[model samples]
Target: MKIAGRTFVVSGGASGLGQACVEEICRNGGNAAVFDLNEEKGAAVIAKLPSGAGKFFVCDVVETDSIAAAVKQTMEWVQETGKPLGGVIPAAGVGNPTTILDRNGDAFSMDTFDFVVNINLRGTIDLVRQCLVHLAKTEPVGADQERGVVIMVASVAAFDGQKGQISYAASKGAVASMTLPMTRDLARYGIRCVTIAPGIFESGMTAVMPEKLFKGLAAVMEFPRRAGQPQEFAQLVRQVIENGMLNGTVIRLDGGLRMPSKI
Candidate 1:
C-alpha cells in the first residue's frame, strides 16, 4: 500500500518510536493522528509537521472508551478529507522493572503485573480491534488488494527477558505471538498484522539509565555497539506497510544483541 495521501493512527505518538513513525509518515506525504495522554508533547509533535498533516488526540489505550472515541473522531476526519485509513501502530507501553521476589523475599505485587498486562497487552489489542472497524471500510488500494496494516511493537525481552522483566516479557511475548493468528483472522478483510521486536533502542525511557548500565547493554551488540535509533524503527514500519507480502511475522530490530540475564 502506498503511504502517500493516506491516514494512519499511531498510539503513543507523542514521543520515542511512535514520534518517529509520525514524522516519517508526514514526511512521506501521509497524515497521522497521534493518540497519546501527553497533550503538550503531542501538540509539540504535531506542530513540527505541516499544517493538517497531523492531529493529536488525548487517548489512554488502557480504556476502551477512550480509544473508541479517538477512532470515531479520526474516522470522521478521514471522511471529511477523503483520505483512506492506511494503518495503525500500537506503540504505547511501560516497562517498570520489578523482581518476582525482592531482596526481602516478598512476592511480586499482583497489581504491578496486572498494570503491565493491561497497558501493554490488553491496551494494544483493544486499540487494534477498534481501529479495524474503520480500516475494514477502506477500499483496497494496491493490486494485492490490501486495505490496511497493523504494526505492533513488541520487544527483545519477549525472547530473552532479563531479571525483573517477567511482566514486560509476558506482555510483549503475547503481542508477538498474536501476529500470526491476527493475520489469519483479518486476512479476509485484506488487513495484515506484523510485530516488531526491537532490542536496545534509545527511547525516552532508556535515556535515564545509568551510564554503566547503558554501556553494559551496548557492549552486547556485535556491531555499532550502541542503541538503535527511532528512525530505524520507523523505516521498518514503512517497509511493512508498503510491502504486500510482509505479514504475520515478528521482525527483530536488535542489531544481533541477545540480552543477558540481569541479576
Candidate 2:
C-alpha cells in the first residue's frame, strides 16, 4: 500500500527510531499519529512536521485504557483528515540489565522482569491488537487487497543475550517469535506483520551507556565500525511498508553485527 494520503500510528514516536519514522512518513506525504508519554518531546516532533502531517497523543503503551483511548483518537483524526489508517508500528520498548542472581547470590527480582516484559513484549502486542481493530476495517487499497501492516521492534540481544540481559532478551525474543504466527492470524483481515531486529544504535536507551561500553559494542560491527543512525532504521521501516512481500519475517538492521556473548 502507498503511504501518501494514509495515516500510520507509531508508538514512541517522540524520540529515537520512532521519531525518525514519523519524520520519514510525513516527509513522504503521509500522516503520522505519534503516541508517547513525553508531551514536550511529542510536541517538538509534531512541530517539526508539516502542518496537518503529524499529531501527538500522550499514551502509555503499558496501560490498556491508554492504548484504547489513543487508538480511538487516532481514528477520529483519520476521519478529520480523510486519511485511512494504513499501519501500526510499535517501537516503544525498554531494556534493563539484571542478572538472574545478584553478586550476593540473591535471586533476581521478579518485579524487574515483569516490568521489562510488560513494556517491551506485552505493550507491543497490546498496541498492535488495538490498532488492528480499526486498521482491519479500512478498505483494501491495492489489487492485493491489502489493509495495513505491523512492524515491531526487536533487538540483536534477542538472538545473542549478553551478560545481565536476561529480562531484556526474553522480552525481545518473544517479539521476534510472534512475527510469523501473528501474520498468519491476521492474514484473513488483509493485514501483514513484520519485525525489525536492530543492533546497537544511537537511541535513548543506549545514549546513557558508559562510553567504554558503547564503544565496545560499536566495535563489533563488521563494517563502518559504528552504531546505526536512527535515519537508517527509519529508511528500512519505510521500505518494509512499501514492499508487499516483507511479511512474517525479522530483518536485522545491524551493519553485519553478529553480537558475541559479551559486547
RMSD of each: 1.0, 0.8
The numbered model that scores best in lDDT is: 2
In model 2, what are the clashing residue pairs, if there are any? none
TM-score of each: 0.98, 0.98
- Candidate 1, 1-263: lDDT as tens digits: 88898999999899999999999999999999999999999999999998899999999999999998999999888988788899999999889879999999999999999999998999999999999988998888667788999999999999999889999999999999999999999999999999999988888768876677677888988887899999999999999988989999999999898899862
Off by over 4 Å in 1: none
Q: How many clashes show up in model 1? A: 0
Candidate 2: how many backbone clashes? 0
Per-residue lDDT, model 1, residue 198, is: 94
Clashes of each: 0, 0
Candidate 2: residue 196 lDDT (0-100): 98
